[model samples]
Target: MTCSACHQGLPADARFCPACGTPAAPGAGRPVPAAPGLPLPEDKRKPVTVLFCDMVGSTALSGALDPETLRTLTLRWFGLMSAEIEARGGTPEKFIGDAVMAVFGVPHVHEDDARRALAAALGIREALKRFNAELERTLGLRIGIRIGVNTGQVVAGSDATARQALVSGETVNVAARLEQNAGPGEILIGPQTLSAAGPTVAVEEAGPLALKGKTDRVPAYRLLALGADDPELLRRFDIAFVGRRTELARLAEETHAARRGTRLLHLAGEAGTGKTRLLREWRTRATGPGHLVHGAGRCRGYGDHGSLAPLADAVRTVLAEAPRSADGHQDDIALGVLAAGLLDDGTPNVPLEEMCAALATVLARTARTCRPVLVLDDWHWAPPPLVRAVELLHIRLGDAPVLLVCAGRPGGAAPPATAIPLRLEGLDRAEAARLAADLIGAPRTPVAARLLERAEGNPLYLEQLLLPADAGTPALPDDELPPTLQALLGARIGALDPAERFVLDIACVVGREFDPAELARLAATAPGTAAPPDGDEPPTVLPVLQRLRRRRLVEPVGTGPRSPYRFAGGLVQEVAYASLSKRTKAERHEQAARLPSVTQAGDAAVGGHLERACRLR
Candidate 1:
């Protein structure tokens, strides 16, 4: 054998150049293995980035060019693309006719696999541009290609060719679909790719695209440039951060204490109440001085069912930043324990106590050098083992200068003993109105006021209500609120008593505000009125309305005979109405049409309800 590097002849079994001392390339001096059947090695679950690139006009090119000419062009094209992919440390998996597929984090895994795949994709774009220019000049033809990049967990293995490949999963499928969906000469990327690339790679918001074979649309972006945005890759709500001064001040004080020694703080709030945003704002403000090691992790409601998922994420972040820490020994030990306990690609089967002790010891050791701040978001979704890990971290690192901030919806495992609880509520009326104006780009109008009323000061509610479809002049449109809010409110309503839910459903039809007298009269007189399906007599309307009032689904708006009860907010009414089937809605609306209040609103109101009811099949 001869060395590829120095062209020196070597023995048959040599692994390195004896004279030149250059190690041979991987798998050199080894016998080729027999073809493995269907499954291949490296067929385990792990995070990976897949990239697909396709020629735009292969059929036309094939028809126009001679077979020999087309074959030459295809080979040259594949060579150019393969070089780019390999240059960025990716494996060019295979070629399918006019398309080339490459994958990163298989055969071997890299921390920056996603970034590598993305870089390779961008590199291919430049190479293709240069190739097309040269082809146009030399061959009197110009060609275009579209590329798609995605990062996900895939079952990666070789196919029948004995080639290293992504054998199965929706990850590679999504990448192919994304490539097909891309515009000519455009590069599109999935959400995971964008996230792993961080904010360093500037990307234009391409919105969501409905890729084939996927039940739901995938969020995608177009690669623009390479530089981070101001706040990094975190979700930019575009709505100004408003009405969190007090919470920020409290967090600042707690963080200051943490800098001195161990301090744990919990930022608790309901969904859409600005927990994550407030955390980000504080991160930007607290990034200087004694805060040297800052790592954050979050628990997801989906795709994070593993034990210690949040802690694993946080440990990975710490290891990624460990080289900057002054205490190299502590960093090494911490990273070693973390990687072994939870960070490895395989599922860990360690005892909960052992995992906690390892994490706490590492965290304590690292905190002594520079103040280490760990932020754990969405702790409500964290498993019991992870929650125990947080407590253990506090117990072991109590004297270390480490700050642990956790945020989530309330009522899970209790937080650490030393942790201070900071509860976040909705914005006030004036602040919410100001935020609406800022988002809508207009002065406060009656429409904005109505929207604010419906939103009930919830920031997410306000922002969603102002999205293009729901945004209208003079009033908030009578349409379905955002799906996120619908799901959230649905879960809440699902917890209510069936009888209470039934009363609330009818009240929704009676309009936002209703008198019990009217609701009861309508229910009694409505066609096909029946007792409760459970064989129990229906409860009186006034008592049920009072129970709903206590539940905050409805509120008593007036004293006697007038509008005694109104929905807690317009959104509450809308969600309740939306949850009902068409037939039920029509029946409720028909019953409501008989109310004297509806008659008082005049023929238009009564006619509207009756017409809507009639339209139902």
Candidate 2:
């Protein structure tokens, strides 16, 4: 039998052509020999990136130039465009009049096919500029080109006779539409192409476009430069990053170590701490210099299949960003592992040990070529399988130049002893003040200082505290915290043990600061009772308060039995108070209002609580 694409002879029993790698004819035991240069559309469909480039004003150029000159110019255009496409690893599929169509991931699949197509489109546009300049000098005529790129699943194979392989699908149509929509000397790309190319490519929003043959409008982006203009693309808010210089320095050191050997670093912190921000800063500085970096996050909810989701996502990205030429025996083994564990492709299932080994092989191959950094956020939410994958990578690829950086809330199964632990703390008073001022965009009000005091240096908390309210409103009491802040702190409070939560709830109604003796007295009394102080009989709230103290949810104001305990921040008390039922709140308030301790303070204080309890519906 003979191969149709490259005309190489193949075994009669072979299912695919060896030289061209095209599948044998459908229902044929062997591929039949065919004439060269024939078009054959196959039934199999695969993901591919398509590029379409068209010359501007072809009819006018033909009319202005002689027949021979027009033919020469057209030939020159096709030659230069095809060369550019081929240079970027794209196959120049066909020439349709003045347009050139190119395909990537055809004949064979490539990891970065979409990225290569983008590069080729940019190159073709630049080539046209230089080509037109030469034409202007010699033929006194200039021509512009419009290029478009799209990535999607496309039908790929030989037609009925299996003579020639063809690439055609909605991906091709979208690319053509984008080219038509593009202005002269401009390039446009579909959203999927933009996404596959990743954040490295800079682009401006082109808005949704009405493309022909597509029922819905297609969102497009104008292709810009390749490098990112803003390095911190994933930053949450536009607020200035104030602190974390020490963490930044540590990341730099770890990154330097990653160049020589694998390094695993876990960034642990509370929700409002700067774990993600610190990472964004590190990534902004440490991405280049012969390094391939990919990051993915574990989500809050995946139900039953949550364990391997993070690892599966990271593995998919690693495979996608891998170089096309890296395909070898090792690549095949690794891909087989992925097919069984992560990918949806129909490959024989493999054991977990083999799957992890294959995964290591893939990462090791990439690391041998360039430093590979995998950042997994929300590690605490990761399932056992994902955590195990990380452990496997640490053991197998320890000597390889791979760096794994994970960030999440602490207190899950800790990483291996060799892994570096970087715990992020909230900003200091000075740093918090600066961050708060930056957020409020005004001179420091008492409210601002109070917010900084309550927020306790947590960046997310500080931001929520300073969120703008309606203008010209009267000053809010320091205890009246923002609803967003309340909700955030409430979630943290809800996570505490039942006993710990109960103590905090009662302490909230006792005031910003409460004596254990006073709290115990009120706890044993009813709403209508006028309770007397229980003279420091070793308050039962002490044990629970001790736990809250260790959790950083509360703090001791002074020494001795009569000393007061305050919620670590004002927001904590507010959130605790907000969590109670109306009946419980009113009961707690009325009981406190009738206490001898409250009456000794003043009539105003007692009146305040009594009025609140009555107003409670």
Candidate 3:
């Protein structure tokens, strides 16, 4: 057989052309074969969220329309659906007949891939509504689609680098089954996806489903609208706010300074470290007679929202709250234009400088009457244009009583040089224990202690760990960490570059703590490992390790090159270790057993590694 598009030779069973990635004729479902002597890309085993969308009653609709019209309509539907998926950081993996399969957390994994997938599914529903309206007007036809979203482990790979269907395993199969099981216009999601998406998603239990090819029934949920309850608000009002008194005091100082002059403060921490909580607490305190206008905006991980999205959100908040001028209808119009321009749909009507100038005008006007507090969350995702616009706005304010604050994960775009920086570490043991005690309603209990130990001072981890207890499952098993927490940590590890991930995988196998020299030795000796750069004297692992350190994945145990390093948290180590393939784990363990450090420890230590490795193999 041959590919009609490119005239490239193809295997009879090939589903896509290896030369041009064109799908084979209708009903050709096998994967394309790789070129001889060229190894296929290694399969990645990780947690991914899969979305399956299928048009309802396609066979009937096809019978009503000619083949060409049906093809055109199907292509239009695919384009709209693909846009929705891509906008939310998902890959539209393939189109099968009138069905679409999309996956999130492939190629790049965000900590919120499950949430992104859910959002994309919702977006698709809304988009379809508009598309249906257009179809009804233009062609007197409307279509409905059923969507199923599932989150679980999948072996993801591509036949080639070009975009192609990449995910496989039970996860994909279950997702497809979910779509088939759903009623038209309904969205069904598996339990794991629901859990990983966090509480912001509103869902109703769909009961257990006996899916095809599965021995056990799979629990499912019908996705409702995304909840409006702010997660930070939930934490603030529900969870006891312990620790961080000093950080709050520092923010108070900044607020006071802002009353006298412009102030910029940046709050940085790892995921689940309570950066958002701190901002909420400070915002609550900062609002009063003196501070009149306050607004907060968060950057999203999905969609092609313009660089100024967060700013737009803040501006909208300000416009809503800022007292409408008795004679300032014109001012309202200007502010409204400014807010609309910040939207993601298109370019701002005015030049960026002009927009910044208008923003400065509003802030200055609001500052004259009362202080304006603008909090931009997730500044790490801020693009350069937004950053530049912010700097320009700051300079243009000229000491107006405006306070600008940003909160985001560490290692993101740095704040302006003049901005004050506050870094949040995990809560101390006392605080963590108190938080756990409050959540579980028990003090000094064994479960509480275990929870505190595992949480390692991260407030988010502690909160997630106690979710099962809240749901009436009181037993806290040592081996079973919450899938939500696992997905969160796993996404972080999965985001690492190939070289960094390889070294980190080895480090996970080498125990939580390993010497730099020992890690380099293992990386250099690992089987089938990529060779180090030519003329690179020492192994390249050290630099990769440093990069990981900067990202807060690992930290130094002590000073100096010889000082050992360990994963920042036990959970991080567990997630990284869990992500490694069994074969790779066996290889790394065997390699570690031969290291000089293992030999010095004794024959028993070496024997342990070899024994575990042998068992794994």
| Candidate closest to the true structure, highest lDDT | 3
lDDT of 2 by residue, 1-617 (tens): 33333223456676775433445555333433221211121233445788888888988988899999888889988998878776655678888898988887655444456777887787787887798789989999899888888877666652223333477668889999999999988889887676556557888878588999989888888999775322145223577778889999998888888777789998888777877778876777775467566655453311234345666666667667756445444577676667765665312257656766777777888765566677777665554445666787788886788888878775433454567999898899988888777777763643356667778889877765555543212234656654334434543554454456556767898898888767766654634333445563423567668878976788899987668898877767866676565666787788888777788999999998988889885
Candidate lDDT values, in order: 0.68, 0.68, 0.75
Flag the better candidate by TM-score, 2 or 3.
Answer: 3
Q: What is the TM-score of each candidate against the true structure?
A: 0.53, 0.53, 0.85
Estimate, for each residue in 116-234, the C-alpha lDDT of model 3 and write its tens digit. 89888999999999999999998899999999999887766523234764778898998999998999999999887877776778888785888999997888889998764355644
lDDT of 1 by residue, 100-155 (tens): 88987554444456767777787788988898888898889988999888876565
Candidate 3 stretches with Cα past 4 Å from truth are 1-42, 137-140, 158-162, 233-236, 287-289, 319-348, 443-449, 469-477, 530-540
**Which ten-residue region of model 1 has the weakest summed lDDT?**
34-43
User: What TM-score does prediction 1 earn?
Assistant: 0.53
Clashes of 1: 1
Model 3 worst lDDT window (10 residues): 32-41
Pairs of colliding residues, candidate 2: 40-159, 41-158, 41-159, 42-157
